[model samples]
Target: MIRPGLTVKLSLLLACIGVIASGATGYYAYRANRNMLVNEAELSLLTSTELLGQRFSTSIDDVGADALVLASLPSTAEVAQSDDGLRRNSAREQLANVYSSFMVHHPEYLQIRLITREHHGLELVRFDRDADGLVRVKGDNLQEKGQFAYVFDTLTFSPGRIYTSPIAVNHEYGTHAAEGKPTLRLGTPVSNAQGAVVGVVVIDIDLEGLFKRLQNDLPSDYRVYLANEWGDFLVHPDASKAFGFDRGRRVLMQDSFSVTKPLFAQVQSEVRVNGLARPKQAAGQVLAFVRRPFGDSEGNRFIVIGLAKPLDDVLSGATLLGNRIVRMVLVFSVLALFLAILFARALTKPLHSLAYAATHLFAGHAMETLPLDRTDEIGLLARCFDRLRREIRLQMDALHTKQRELAHLATHDALTELPNRVLFLEKLERAIEEATQRQEGLAVLFVDLDRFKQINDQFGHAIGDKVLVAVARRLKQVLSSADVVARLGGDEFIVLIEGQRSADGASAIAARVVNALNEELSVDGQSMTVGASIGISQFPDDSGTAEELLLNADAAMYAAKADGRSAYLRYHDVLEARRREQAEQAERARAGEGATAGREAEPTA
Candidate 1:
């Protein structure tokens, strides 16, 4: 055989190296792409899980509010107090109608009952939804429930406070539709005029029904999981796994998903797991879990909400890319072998460019332009990277949305959704700066609710909360949209009015607030009224600083209260009187000092 030239030998050697290198790169790229896709899917699933938890909390609150409303009704209390038979009967009938109305509106409600603290927690009036519709049960049919936790635990609470019972299978006799079904009980104490807890208004929620509704909008493929504080699965895609503890043997989530053990211990608020990590329960899947507070209590009562998606679904794009990469490797090997003799040096630039882009793909900057216009394998790789960038940006946008929601929650009150002190001060400082620059003035109104404490004491904190919500709503209604209103803790709210620093202008706004609060209010069918005492202070005229302006307004508000409840006072009015008294005291001191000096100058020993 004739010996090949040196150039031919070099070409064959370079060709063999190119084939191996292309295959190795393809394998690694496939692995990296799979990881990236899994990460994005995990983040997305985690956000969705958190959102579901919030929705569940909101639903619980709604149920609690309904229970509170029933408990607060005067008729419910009247029946519970054991009044005259005729009067009690009338009240029961009227209240039963209201209960039926609620049941009609809320399909998820299994039963609504007023259980009296007396007669061993006898059900005074009850409405249960059966196979047909709402059925009213009364008289001898009303069963004693005092032995149940929902009744005794709720009666222990003060008026207006809600009690959320642990979710369980309802085994109560004569429960009709709720019998042997997963139930969540929300109860509030019903207090008579004497502020005695006479009865408990308890609403039985169909736990599965409620979650079904909550998850209606979720994708069909996504699986949901719920575990109680003990990690007992309360909800699972496979119904057989849920409520396993009720069946005797406990199936704990921590045991299934080992990584979730910290959640039960309150060590981690959230956790994400994937099949690649080889967590047994999460095999072939991606799962995200968030620990959510179960009730309004400060206790350790909580639930873990989780969402899972198939790993195969997450890797579908990666699979497609892998196939494309395999083909590209095969085509590029041939091209490399042909070009190796003359263009070996040219291949280094594209390979280096691809490597740099891959390394810095997530460094928070765009990759320097890639050679995407070329029809070669390098261009195909560049195009895949560009697509990957778009997918990442979409995931980032979702993360940004969740971040904004978290920031808003941090700055705003959870109850009233009004700006908290920190956020209010920030806004005030900005407003002050703007007003100073524009050479304009603004007004700050400090408002204190009168008789609120008395109402809170009589009704219980649950009703007190509703009263505050009502007050917040009224305040918003009284002020223009341009004005800012914030709750400064209990029974105190502050308002900022731009271009209204004049005494007349500020007083007019304050007057509107007082009048709005003074109007008779009806909550839960109980009539009550509250008054407002407002103190006004003007920016630039009162004080340039936000803190001083707030202090002056506070001082003026006290003056308003001193004058009488349901009144308004200006800071300047209070300041002028204080200034006169201070000046008189200074003059008197000077005169006394002069007299003392003259006596000393007489040299009388």
Candidate 2:
């Protein structure tokens, strides 16, 4: 017969084995579920990204097509044939009509303008409504003679063809605007009936409005970002100042064009590595990235579109099954322990009198009468509980620590030891709500390093990281305890300043920050000067909600960069009008050039 102690030890060992097996199964199932969920999320995001990218491309194409149509208008040709003074007037009327039609049909378009080939000056024919519901026109010339000299020179140098340039802030306009305002200029050679090259027609567009429309297309939980070939954040949903392309007062190409040399090389390898296509049915998790060539040449830049999803969400049901099994095992183990304790108590009672006699005999230094006891289940249970209590106490402490560590790692940034984006945004929303209710002002500023990429490209990322750390130190020193500052990622930082009295008060803080950051930072015995362009938007005044406030602030920040770096700008109505005008001019130029050659040839025939 098994002794009570042996019976108890055997039961404990069996329970431990069962628990361990259950835990292993549960862990495997949890991991599988997590992977599936991640895969699903990534896939969803990827699909959305592709759909959005297609939409964006389609919109751009539409703008181009519309531009082509406007350029072919008889009124545009008449303006081209007329003298300079009459041409300007005719161009104005034609531009107004085009702008009205385009805006009415495609509210995504901001404005339209026409540029002449000879003078290369810009004229503002269409003024779009600003944030405050005011319509404003660009005071610059149509040909961009004095202003947009680069744009004019590029068009003039390459005449009778359509050219697309990066979105740039028109400093001449002096307003804060975001980048990615795609300007499509079509330079058509105005020719006589004999087909001689004469003047050129131009069209410009503001893609910012299109971006806004596209953003609305995305789900609330998902974020849509438009990066240049380079990894710079072009259009981030978060109006956090950390977004935008500013390179030491000059804007760096942050779109797909900004990929690292090595990364680009790898991308090239993937493109040419093999002709083999991806499999139709892949298992587990899959990250699909497609590199499509931009422009009409082999050497054109490639746009990398990636789609990812979590494997866990996809297999949550499987995980639930595992969890239930583990729970059942735990319940059984607890029931067994309780029954063992009751049996142990019942069996020990008979021994209690014997134990008391033995204790008295030991105290008196005399032999005690031995009570004969038979081996039974109750005695075995008492021994089992004794063993379980000892083992459980030993393991519980270590398990708790491990669990806490895991929780910490999930919420904190490994590099900075600070709360990550998830935590920061959570707090930010709460802060915004509290401030809004109190009728206090709150400001969100998105701060981006002027030329952080250049530093990384020139000195390597190690040095670049060092520079970032130093900058972060300075940022912490500048802000108040109440203010929330977070590194969204890379060289971008977001500052949420609460309890402001007015919008100007927030502006003043932004100015102070710009000034503070304007100083030279010494890194690795080399001193480099970088400036910041801050976009400030106040609560209630700029937006009623946190998301809208952030967007307005972000738009204003882009405006600052567009106006000129090392400055700050608040959201204003006039900025939108100017953006529309720029977009319209670029569109007209594209359409006019295509039709000009054909029209000129017809007259000659």
Candidate 3:
């Protein structure tokens, strides 16, 4: 190979440097965006999984409550007890009619039976809902189920106590729709007049039906997975994978999702995994798993519920970003090569330093550092560069000022002139940190406007917007200047009260807010009457984190609405009601844990 000239070598070196810089910057940018997308997908999946688990728990609790209700009825005990002739027959008929009504209302209930404790667990009344309609199995058809766990296990419990059977495929002979379907059995012992465990009332819940309703609102791209405590798959995306144990083979969740081993080991209650991080296992998928307790204080039983989405779906935005980055790198590389060739050819002995200074001047060197004293052609060029730098600095300053203005607009609401959700959350986080350091208390008030949607639909959004602005103003006027009042979005506002404040103090603030918004507002000659429901939650009292605090406050706000509009409720009161409900279940649940009622927030105006 012929040795190249100094100019050619220098040009090649400069060109290679420029290409590497562009390629490295593009690569890092692409990676950062990809990682961010994956992280957000993981968080979203986890939230969906948690919500689904809560729903499943709630459904199971409802079924258990129904079983208890039937057991408590006097007619069930009369039918189950050993009695003479017409009276027992009439009681059986009455109870059967009730079971039929339940079947009609809940298509998911495959069978409801009242089994006697005296006749070796003989079925006294039974109603089954098959494909055609509700069928009451009578006479010889009502078989004895003394050996089954749902009967024998339930009869051992005291009155009001619920027995939850393990999930399994129903294989009992003469069963209607429940036969061959995955079923969950809930049973409660029926007591006589003297409060003795005389019989058991059982309800067979179709597992597939319960899950179908729970997953109805989820996105179509989502895949649901469920497994027992033993890691055996009960429900999977692939039908063949589900109930594999019944088919004489075993398909385990932990075996498929290696990251889920921690869940089986009881090391972690929740796990999030993405295919991009580990392509060999969950290839092209992002998954979240949560371990939820399945039974009412029985056997310490739990189930793993998971949701998965396609990696391609989650990374769609990142893919677009990567393509843009690739184009930018290519253009920069070509431009750098052309400029390197020209610079190499033009640089002479004296001009080389000048060229180097020109290249680095924009990189953050002072224009005064250039050789302006030399009265030559190079000096003239240096002076020109100095002048150009000054002009660019002024333009940069103006650009920075514009950027700050845009940032303010992004964080604050244009309609209300108050902090928006994004800014409010940031401030809440900072306040929480300060409160924790100072060992002080803080509170968050979640305010929701009642009847705002009706007004918006009747009049127009313009008037509704005016009402929102008015509401925001009144909220600010009601709260002290030290407190932060923010409009979270249409018909909803949030307040952050920092410093030491008792629950009573927060309630006082909430009451003032409710009264303020409850007043009639005349917006553009239209008299609009709006009421406020405020929920208050305190830091370190209701929750320690910002997200939990907001959620608690939101829950309390709904309770206020439920009590009656234009009222305020503390988050502590919501917890108190839940505590009372759970206390009632304490007799039935050994763990003293039961389903807490949930309320949905109203749609934004």
Q: What is candidate 1's CA lDDT for residue 354? A: 86
Give the higher-TM-score candidate: 1 or 3: 3
Q: In angstroms, give how far residue 487 of model 2 lies from its true place.
A: 68
Error at 183, model 1, angstroms: 0.9
Best TM-score among the predictions, by candidate number: 3
Clashes of 3: 0
Which portions of model 1 miss their true places by more than 4 Å? 1-13, 83-88, 279-281, 343-605
Off by over 4 Å in 2: 1-19, 86-95, 121-161, 174-203, 237-244, 247-325, 331-605
Compose the digit string of candidate 3's lDDT tens values, residues 1-605: 98997688778888989999999999998888888999898999999999999888888889988998898888888878873222348777877888888888888898999998876788888888788988888777778889998898888898988898888899999888888999889999999999888889999999999899889999999999999888989999999999888889989999999889999898899999899998887899999999987657755667899999999999899889989999999999999899888887877455564766677666546565778887988788888888787788899999999999999899999999999999999999999899889899899999998989999999899888888888888888888999998888878899999886544488888878777787889999988789888888899989999999999999999998999988988888888998998987876675333332222223331
Q: After superposition, how far is residue 421 of candidate 3 from its true place, in Å?
A: 41
Each prediction's total of clashing residue pairs, residues at least 3 apart in sequence or on different chains, is: 0, 86, 0
- TM-score each candidate: 0.55, 0.41, 0.56
- The CA lDDT at 316 in model 2 is 58
Q: Residue 537 deviation, candidate 3, in Å? A: 39
Taking all chains together, the TM-score of candidate 1 against the true structure is 0.55
Off by over 4 Å in 3: 1-12, 83-88, 338-605
Per lDDT, the best of the predicted structures is 1
lDDT of 2 by residue, 1-605 (tens): 95567346555655566566656766777666655555555556656666766766666556656655665665554554553533347555655666666656765544454544445444434345345432435444222442454345434442334444444433334222212343333233334454443344444455556666865866554434444454444454444421354433322222222322333444442211101122223233333333333321322433444333323334557668666867876876676566655565555555554444434433322222332232565445444444454566667888899899988777666555556667777777897789768877777887777778888898888888888777777777887777777776777777888775345467777777888788889989988866788777777667777677667777877888887888887775436657788899888987898789789899789
Candidate lDDT scores, in order, read: 0.87, 0.56, 0.86
